[model samples]
Target: MFDRLRLMSDYEAPTPVWAPASVGAFVLSPTHLDHLGLDETLRTRLLRWQQYFDDHHPADLCGWDSPGSSQRYASEGEQLREELERALPGLRVELDLWPVPADD
Candidate 1:
C-alpha cells in the first residue's frame, strides 16, 4: 500500500512525504501528512489520508504554458499544491497531477 512515495531532496526541517518533485520515493508518517497543509485538523487529516491512499494514488502534474516554455511545470506544481491543501478530509485527491488509483 505504501509504494508510490516520491523521494525528494533532503529536507532541512520539513519531512519529505511523497513530494511531487522529481527527486526520490519515501514513505509518509502521520505527522508528515499533516504538514502537507490540509485544512482539516491534523489528526483527522492523517487518518483520512491513510484510508484515502489505501485505494487511490496521487498522480504527478505537468501543465503547459504558452507555446513552449518551462512555466507549465511550475504552474502544474502550484495547482497540485492547492489541490492537496483543499482536498483535505476527503479521499478525492484534488491535487494529483497525474492521479492514478493504486488499485489500477
Candidate 2:
C-alpha cells in the first residue's frame, strides 16, 4: 500500500490531482487509471471525485473571483480527504489548499 496520498487543486487547472505525500512531481490524474495498484472500487471513487471537482469549479483561474470560492474549494478538498481516509484507513491523506486569492 502507498504510504501517503495527497489531494490537491492546482492553478493550472481546478481538477483534483493525487500524488504521493513525499513526491509532488509525480501525480496521477483521473484518466490514468490502469494498473495503479488501487482496487477498482477506490479507483471509481477517485474518478467520481475528480469529475465532481471539475464540474463544480471553473477550469481556469477565474474561479477564484467568485464569492465564497475559497470556502467552496476547501469544502470540496475536505470532503475528498474524508473519502480517502474512509476508503483507505491508516493512509495519510493531505489536502493541500491552494493559495488564497487576494480580496478585490
Candidate 3:
C-alpha cells in the first residue's frame, strides 16, 4: 500500500507521483476520485477541478495561461490536500505548487 498521496495538475492525465518507483508513494489524481473514499463535497470539488482543467487546458500541458483559472485550481488543490488528509489520516498528503509554467 502507498503511504503518501500527491495532488497535482497534468495534461490529459496528471501524474501526481513525485518519483518513478519511489517507495511508499503514489498519485491521487482526479481519475481515482471515484474509487477513493472521499466525502461528497470534497469529491465534488475534485470533479469540478478535473472538468475545469479538461475544458480550459484540454490540449495544453498546464493551465498557466489563464491566471485566474490556474490560481483557482491551485487553491482547490490545497483544499483537496486538507480534505484528503482528514479523510485518510493514514496517508501523507502533498499538494504541488500550482501555476507552474509549462516550460518549467
Candidate 4:
C-alpha cells in the first residue's frame, strides 16, 4: 500500500528503521515541501501533526516515559494518518492520542 501510494503521488516511502535519524529529520523539514512539490492538503496534514505534537506531551503506548519513543511514535503515526487520508478521500477519522488499554 505504501509503495503504491509513493508511485501514485508526491509522497515518498519512509526509510528503513535502521536508517539515520538525519534522513527522518530531512523528511520532516519544510524544505521537502519545495523539493517534493506537495499539495496544500498534504502540507496542511503535516502542519496538523506539528500542532498535535506541540499541544500534547509525549507518552508511551504503556503510558510511561520512554525518552525518545513518543516522538518517534507520533511522527510515524502522523505519516500513517497522512497516507491514509491521501489513499482514502473523504474518510472521516478520529485519533485518540491517549488511548486506554483494552483491559481497562
The TM-score leader among the candidates is 3
In model 2, the runs with Cα more than 4 Å from the true position are 12-15, 21-24, 31-63, 101-104
Tens digit of per-residue lDDT, candidate 4, span 19-92: 12334322234554434455666656655544434333333323424435455545555575556555446542
Better of 3 and 4 by lDDT: 3
Write the number of the candidate with greater TM-score, choosing between 2 and 3.
3
| lDDT score, candidate 3, position 38 | 70
Q: Which digits, one per residue and each the tens of the lDDT, describe model 2 over residues 1-104?
A: 36677777553342355667466545665554353445676666556555544555556644555556566666756876786677666778887765444452
Which residue runs of candidate 3 sit more than 4 Å off their true CA positions? 14-35, 60-65, 101-104
Q: In candidate 4, what residue range of length 10 has the lowest lDDT sum? A: 1-10
Candidate 1 local lDDT, 1-104, one digit each (tens) = 22224422122213223633334334455566665554555435334433333323222222222222223333444444455545543333323323222322
Q: Rank the candidates by lDDT, best first.
A: 3, 2, 4, 1
Model 4, C-alpha of 25: deviation from truth (Å) = 5.3
User: Between prediction 1 and prediction 4, which has the larger lDDT?
Assistant: 4
Clashing pairs in 4: none
Best candidate according to lDDT: 3
Q: How many backbone clashes does candidate 2 have?
A: 0
Question: On a 0 to 1 TM-score scale, where does candidate 2 land against the true structure?
Answer: 0.60
In model 3, what are the clashing residue pairs, if there are any? none
Count of residue pairs whose backbone atoms collide, per candidate = 8, 0, 0, 0
Compared with the true structure, all predictions reach lDDT values of 0.38, 0.60, 0.61, 0.39
